[model samples]
Target: MRRSIPCLCLAAALLAPAAVQARVAQARIARMHTPVATLEQVQVRLDWAEHADSGQLRIRAGRVDAPALGYHFRDLTWTCPLRRTPEDGWQCEGALRGQGVAQRALALRGQGAAPLRLGIHFDVDALTATLAQGQARLALERRTATPDLTTLILTRVPLVWAQALLAQAWEGASFGKGTLDGRLAIVAPAAAPLRVSGPLRLHAAALQNADSSIVGEGLGGDFQLAYVGSAAARVTVAGVLHGGEFLVGSTYVALPPAPVGLHIEADSAGAEGWRLPRIEWRDGDVLAGSGRARLAPDGNVRELELQAHSGDLGPLAPRYLSGWLGVLGLSGVELRGGVDMTTRIEDGALVEVTAVVRDAGLHDPAGRFGFDGLRGDLRYSAEAPVDSQLQWTAGELYGLEFGAAAIPLRSGDGTLRSRAPWRVPMQGGSLTLSDVAIRPAREDAGADIRFGMALEGIDFGRVSKALGLPAFTGVLGGEIPSAHYANDRIDFDGGLTLHLFDGTVRFSELALERPFGTAPSLTADIALKGLDLARLTEVLGFGTITGRLDGSIEGLRLVDWTPVAFDARFASYPAPGVKQRISQRAVQDIGSVGDSSFMASLQGQLIGLFSDFGYRRLGIGCRLENQICTMSGLSGSAGAQDENAFTIVEGSGVPRLDVIGFNRAVDWTTLVQRLLAAGKGEVAPVIE
Candidate 1:
């Protein structure tokens, strides 16, 4: 029984081994053909139904692959369906794998849902790659229906070069509507250079390179560029910029708030070196031309040349380029002109420049008139640490007039030395003498002055009338031409003879300064032999002031544009036919108009000091100083017998009225106001 039992056990062992091998073979066949519900590493499990069911399948895997499509998935799990469609194509639907900073769940759809095309959508944030190879094209469509109004439609992008492709289109996506439509060729990792070249139309595009040291502005314009080589490599661009403005340093320059033209051709070397071949701009009536400005490796301007021009001077003259007064210390004046300038820059500073003003005009807003026919040349060299000297020469009076007198003038020359306190040295000029001449108009004062003047033949009445002064009406005619004021003091080295109303008078060497300070004082010596009083009274509006009127005004000054004290005397002379009753009112009016009357001053202080302030066969002498008049004699008091009369009525050292000739009378009210203003803080001892 033992031997028989051994034989039965041996038979049972051989049969058990054969049955185990059969079961293992069937299991292998099931795994090869059917989809698994879950799998890990080399182990997998399949769900088998006892009867027929739907072809839908659930898949879970640590790794999976479809060698037919060259796709691989790792650590993935998905629910999909495999069904045979009536068209004889298989259909699969399930969740696709997603990964990275971008969270994306791809919705897999095939021909059934794709309308004869397969489509996939991914909620991807970002993508990067190193290489790509494919002949098949891929198109992706993504949309966000809520939370944001962002929509993306992408097509024909390679996987290994995704990052470079996206970067090339970033600027176009930032302006206007933040949208971009363009084509680009990108090489990832830039083993050579990541070349990205394209023409992009932007709806809304903007760029901010925080890592860059310089900011790019006016980016809303049309752009076409090519980037080659490394991350900081060669670049070329050619396009027109419009509708925006930019700034460099603190100069805020803007386009005309409207559309402006821009033309550019630029190239760069490795991000740090660059040059512009030609850049031109045109807007309105102005044009600007610029040359290349290349940056050194040290980030400084290696070279630059920029120039601008405008046909109409009004636009840039007053605002950007103020001339003359801006150069001079004067105010309330502007200069208008066209410009031609060229500048060279090295190491970020202006090294040298040459500029010129073609034709310009000097305009005064205060109605002082203007001077045209102005042209000049200017040059500057910063290499010397000082502004370069400039010289200007001009000719012709474009349009010059003063008061009511119109004097024609010839050519003139001047040199403006640009030193510490710049100086203007003006030389030659000539003016035609008018029919009458007294004090020349302020604008024409020094026009025709010469070395020596002799008043041997000039009509004194004509002179007096032209100067707005009271007419002497005496027969004093002869030419007293030529006077000089170059040395600071006005000196008339001429003589005038007076023959009127049976009197003879003469003046020699008459010199005068406007003020006592800094100006050369006047020292004149005159002789009046016999002068008629009637004609003097008729012309002077005084009370029959009969006198020879022989005296000299020494130390005179009209420099204050006002008056000051001088020395004079008066004596008696015989004459007739002059008006007798010179009303005090008339005297006061004349004094106020002339604004330089001693009689006006005394009338306010000592009224009626002389009942009818007139002198007949009278003589007096006085010295004025320190605001006090030292009267030496009244009438015939002292042996001072000079027919010409002079009254020195002074108060605080305030100046006297600058009244020339007999028009020296002033109103009492006006005299008081002027005295008050001129003597606000000055007080002196009174002499009764």
Candidate 2:
């Protein structure tokens, strides 16, 4: 309606000269062209009574098209009463109707086939017009004294009414819901850039791009915008936005109920895209920032420089970081901190970052890891050397608690390294770290890290208690030559050694995958030597045995810290200084655990007379896979005469007792239950 009224007013002004000469007049033009619109088959008729001050006027056009403004109309007709004012200015007011005009103009208003009321006042030097429907109105004015300038006042106008105008600056943008009330001044000259400056108040606005990657909903704001369209266009907008949610790529922001201040200035860079000279954001004390950035033609950020601070990060994750945090499976993480940071990016890559932290802390409700009392000045640079330090009062990894340590760091040439070894106290021992180097992830590669660690005199008894294992006292001390982490996995170059039960236990080929993710996995191989079987059996609550034990567990795998597969073998062997003796209760328990039968050299009744016996050798092995344990014993083969038998104990003294196993395959879960029952003395044996 607003667009068509201007052309109608022009037609009236053109007929003014002829109207003054004749009381009744008719005129026709095959075609007419004006700066605003083009008309075909135009006709005008006017009737006046002699000595009257008003006349009946009618106008018709076969077609009116304004291609530059995205408006087209057919068979347009207008009827009005034209009156001459005391100042001799011509004024006309009436309802305008057309085929394409009413539909295109009222499409956004949802008014079906309703005529638009248009009123125009024109003198030789100045003109004003108003187009209205219901509560919505648009008024336009111009003067010959300033032909290139036009002033427009809008009241309760639907934002969709300017879709065509918005497309001139931002292609593929559509306004879904909203209304605007504002005043605008447009200066467009034939030889200069088209400029529009306005103050607009937006209410419940919603907008989205073609791909919906960028979107806003329930947005309200008071904004001042200045836009210039030329070969190198520029735009500036400053506003206070309240009660909205917007998403851009992986960043989603749910604006607080309170208003947030914002300002931006940008200039078009043609094919290179756009350059933003300044950006400012403020949301009370929760967040504040200023930045500059460049954007590619596809709307990806190419480069950025930012300096920002936050007084409280408690609400930061949900308000601004939820999209990314949810993607990384850390949605339940909580943070309480204060931080200030400065960062720079070049060519879509991060080049430098510096941050100061004040008593910041983070916790994961799932208990994977957490830290507290962190204070630091952390810095990273890709080109020049930089130094920094960070200290934490306490932390935890997995379920192990550790005391605080300070780390000195230096970075240059795209890599960061520790300046010296840092020691952390855990379980009455210290874990020392050295030669730590880190390379941050890039577009084409994941993060890379290498470090060396040494553990000294860690109390295994306390560790067992903490892990809910049976009591065993020893020291765990070892050095890992190097460890590397990449591609979501960590591999240790060396191994850990533990001293337990007067023996040595070594672990090698250790690797972990997805340590902080769902279903974490671990793989390792363990070898044991010279173990005191008497002590080991006592600690495990098994019947007493006095012997030296050796064992090897290879190809061990655990998922979620539960044993899934292994090849394990344990044996008791005779030694010069060691007694290879087994108690009667131990033999019974072994038979119960291994599903073996006893063969005594003496009578069964006589075997019961002995409380203990000496053993020559005792061995058992199991290869576990897919919930089944393939069992074997010393000198046993599948094709042997006693193919179903496997010895669990072999005695050599008078009235010797030989314990043999008949079952060769056992369910892993059932075997575990048997072992637990035996350890609890729940299995009762009968000698027959």
Please list the C-alpha lDDT of all candidates, in the order they appear: 0.38, 0.82
Worst 10 residues of 1 by lDDT: 25-34
The CA lDDT at 154 in model 2 is 87
lDDT score at residue 504, model 1, on the 0-100 scale: 70
Worst 10 residues of 2 by lDDT: 634-643
Q: How well is each residue in 529-637 modelled by candidate 1, as lDDT tens digits?
A: 6666556655654434434444544544433433346455655543465422322333343333333243333344543343334322344343455444444323323
After superposition, the stretches of candidate 2 with alpha carbons farther than 4 Å from their true spots are: 1-191, 197-222, 243-254, 322-331, 582-602, 605-614, 627-646, 650-679, 682-688
Q: What is the Cα-based TM-score of model 1?
A: 0.35
Tens-digit per-residue lDDT, 554-603, candidate 2 = 99999998888999999987767888888877887888878876777645
Report the number of the highest-lDDT candidate: 2
| Candidate 1 deviant stretches above 4 angstroms | 1-190, 199-220, 229-232, 235-237, 243-245, 250-252, 257-259, 263-278, 295-302, 307-312, 317-338, 360-371, 376-688
Q: What is the Cα-based TM-score of model 2?
A: 0.77
